[model samples]
Target: MHAIHIERHGGPEVMTWSERPDPTPAPGQALVRLGAAGVNFMDVGARSVGAPGWSAPTGLGVEGMGYVTALGDDVEDLSVGDRVAWFYHPGSYAEILAIPATALVRVPDDVPDETAAAIMMQGLTANHFTTETYAVGPGDTAVVHAAAGGVGLLLTQMIKARGGRVIGLVSRAEKAATAEEAGADHVLVSSGAGFEQRVKELTSGEGAHVVYDGGGTATFRSSQLSLRRHGVHAYYGPFMGVPSLPVTDLPNSILLTYPTVQDHVPDREALVTRTAEVFRMVQEGRVVPRIGGRYALSDAARAHRDLESRRTTGKLLLLP
Candidate 1:
């Protein structure tokens, strides 16, 4: 099998495409022939910062979509040739991967492999963020940082589908347009001064009901200011480097919450069920996974470089 492995953590250059022995599925696992792999900021964190849960010299992707090539002895209800997508599994940046049956969700025939791969982690994160963590509701207003990024775009659409008004914060005018096109009610360029004030004005001085902040460190303080009294602040990612905040630093009128999909949705059955709902939304055209760029498997390093430079928008994928 051909896979991209990081022999040691450093930069994108550390990712190397090499041949390795094919993996054999253990009991309750299935072997999948990879079609597309979703490249996420978490993977970049793993390569750049020695992210937790991944060892040195490891295969680097966390999610993908593929077909079942074989199944282990105890695997049932899934057969060889089943088309599926999955997330939170390791070593997915390969031509083949061995995953537990619980991690795999059958992709509807109408959904393409790339869309399935792109949505697994980002869509599920958006689902859990809006539905479980913050509970966005009709007539509610929310703020989404990195509003043109992969999860941001999906989160924007999902919030709109739920009848919530979204204020998208982006770094550039181009990204503002992208966020607006993704169904954001208003787009604010976060590059200028008084951006937090602009968010307050957009929400008619009430501030946002919730703030979905993924760009950590740089936007942390401003995100807190954008929220209303007793509003929830869901911090899902740390793409800008982790922010340090003292519990006492929170506003007296607001509540602070930092939730990750892994922490909020721990049950395998619940994860699968929630992910399936998002997939159904995609199949029915209620939510669309935007493909910003595509690269071949061997060019994975270049893909990482593009992502870290902030030169890409929406989801980037590696075709194997």
Candidate 2:
């Protein structure tokens, strides 16, 4: 088997499609042949510098969907040939992987393989933002940063599915229609910090009920300013830049939180439940991922280059 591995962290150039010994299923593990792998900003971060649990000499992917070819001891629930998807199993960039059975969820027949892979990470993060982070209700307004990107598009749709209005923030005007197509009621094309006024204006000067901010430091304060009094500011963006804030700087009596997707699915039970909801939403057509690009598994470095350029919108996929 071959997988993308990095011996030292640097840029996309650091990733190499190298040969490796085929892995056998270990106890409580299931061997999966890769169907499709989702490319996320988190993957970029992992490739650029090592994140926790992602040290050098490590394979470079976390979310993907595949078929179970074999099962290890005590893995009674899953059978060979079953379609499965996982959101957080490390080293998912390979043509095959030995993932713990507990981390894998059966993919519904209604969901396509690539679609299932695309939605797992970004979809669940969107679910966490809309539900637990702020519990978006009918008529509530939300400001979603990077609205044309993967998480942004899904978050916009989920917010709309719950009957809430979305004021999408995009870095480019050309991406506005994409965000609008995903149910953003309003789209603001702003580079950095000046989007709060438009958000306020759209919300009738009352400000938004919540701001789902994945737009790092430059836009952090703007996201907060776009919220109403007592509104929730969910800052999930850490890649662009991480900003330091003093407690006294918080405005509008709003609540600030960094909602991680891991908390949304702390265990196998939560994983099953959350993924089921995301799959049902896809089957119902409430959430449709725009597959912006697909690259061969060996050519993943180019995919990373395209993503880092910020020219592509929506989800990118890797085919093995």
Candidate 3:
């Protein structure tokens, strides 16, 4: 099997495409013949920082969609040739991956492999953020940073579907248009000065009821200021860098929460159920996964470069 591996943590240059031994399903695991793999910021972080507690040369990729070619013992519910998608497992940037059955979610037959691959990580992250963390409701207002990015677009659409209004923050006018198309009620260009003031104006001086911030340090303070009194702030990612927040700087009455998909949905069954809901939305045309770019598996380095350069929008996938 061929896979992308990072011999040492550094940059996109560290990624190597080479042949490796084919993976066999272990107990409680299934071997998937990957059709597409999702490229995420976490992959870059893992390569740049190495695993939290492991040594170098880690296999990259966190999520993908494929068909089950073989199943381990005790995996009876899912048969051979089951189409599935999954994340939270590692070493997925390959032609074949050995993933635990617990991590797999059955993909709808009508859904394309690319869309299935695109949704797992970003879709689940958006689902947990809006529905679980803030519990955004009808008539509530939300401010989403990086509004045209993968998870941002999905989050904005999900919020809209739940009757919440969203204010999208993007770096470019093109992205603003994309956000608008994805159901963001208001779009703000974060590169300009007075971004926070604009957000405040959008909410008629009251500020948003919730702020979904993923841009990290650069927009952290503005996110705090964009919220109304007693509003919730959900910080889900550090795309720019880890944000530093002082307790004193926060509004005394507001609630601030840093939630991750893993933290919000810890049970495998619950994760699968929520993911099914997301997929249903996609299948029913209520939610759309914007697949911005596709690259061959061997071209993972270029994909990483494009993502880090901020030249792409929505999801990027690798065809295996």
lDDT of each: 0.86, 0.93, 0.86
Residues 1-320, candidate 3: write the lDDT tens digits.
99998889888999999899998999899999999999999888887886574257788888999999999988977889999989777888899988999999888889888899999999989988888898889999999888898988999999999999999988887788899999999988875235778888888899889988877676777778888899888876654577666777788378888888887568887877888888999999888999989999999999999998876889999997
lDDT of 1 by residue, 89-197 (tens): 8888899889999888888888888899999999999998888787888999989888899999999999998899999988777777889999998888884235678
Candidate 2's TM-score: 0.99
* Candidate with the greatest TM-score versus the true structure: 2
Better of 1 and 2 by TM-score: 2
lDDT of 3 at 47: 78
Compared with the true structure, the alpha-carbon lDDT of candidate 2 equals 0.93
Q: Estimate each model's TM-score.
A: 0.96, 0.99, 0.96
Candidate with best lDDT? 2
Q: Any runs in candidate 1 off by more than 4 Å, and if so which?
A: 191-194
> Mind sharing the TM-score for model 1?
0.96
- Candidate 3's TM-score: 0.96
